[model samples]
Target: MSNLNKLDFTTLEVSGRNYLKWVQDVKLYFTAKSLKATIEELIDNEPANEAKKATAMIFIQRHIYDAPQTEYLPEEDPRTFWLALADHFNHQKDIHLLEARHDWQRLCFQDFKSLNEYNSEVCRI
Candidate 1:
């Protein structure tokens, strides 16, 4: 209470803004992925016949199969970051197949057992 007058909020605000910029820089978020060069390739070569299955496979591979393979593992806070991304991808795929696209062919693409089975596997607290 007595020390409140001594605080310099300007420094704190600058540091917080810088920290947020740094976070945006390194975060592999959707915005960054949207700007990636591979998006066009992925969209163009998207398997129309088995898009849902292929999407599920890609999600599984990227999240569960590829995440821990790297030397620099995910930190504790988002150790299962890959899984979360995969969940997002899976949700998007399901929505595209079942709702937005409204493809009757996609009606049979609900054979995604892995995504359904291991949606959120609790590892670290």
Candidate 2:
């Protein structure tokens, strides 16, 4: 269906702030399209597999920001591009974890005027 072909989510940005969510979205999309194999493994010389790989690569490149597009322009295989993106952005998780720990450490019981506000902050952090 035409609706199924339309992209309905945000693209991955250069900042890597949305890397985790982006990866999840990409996986789900690829799975729905039956193209997950293009990123999950090396493709053989079969024409169908080659077409799927091209589709997957185009989808990924179209969903990424300009900086990453230029940087990964030379990459031809979707699997390699996927792994390169993971290698580049996986550190975002550690950075986010450290920031969350810092916020949790700085949280004070008496800082909020209401119990609900304090609880909300705790959930957010």
lDDT (Cα atoms) of all candidates against the true structure: 0.33, 0.89
How many clashes would you count in candidate 2? 0
Model 1 pairs whose backbones collide:
none
Worst-scoring 10-residue span by lDDT in model 2: 41-50
- TM per prediction: 0.19, 0.84
TM-score of 2: 0.84
lDDT of 1 by residue, 15-85 (tens): 12232332234233324433322222345554323443344334323333233334224322231433444
Over 1-125, each residue of candidate 2 has an lDDT whose tens digit, in order, gives 98765665898989999999999999999989998888885357533367888999999987898999899889999989999999999999999999999999999989999999999999998
- Top of the candidates by TM-score: 2
User: How many clashes (backbone N, Cα, C below 3 Å) per candidate?
Assistant: 0, 0
Off by over 4 Å in 2: 1-6, 42-48
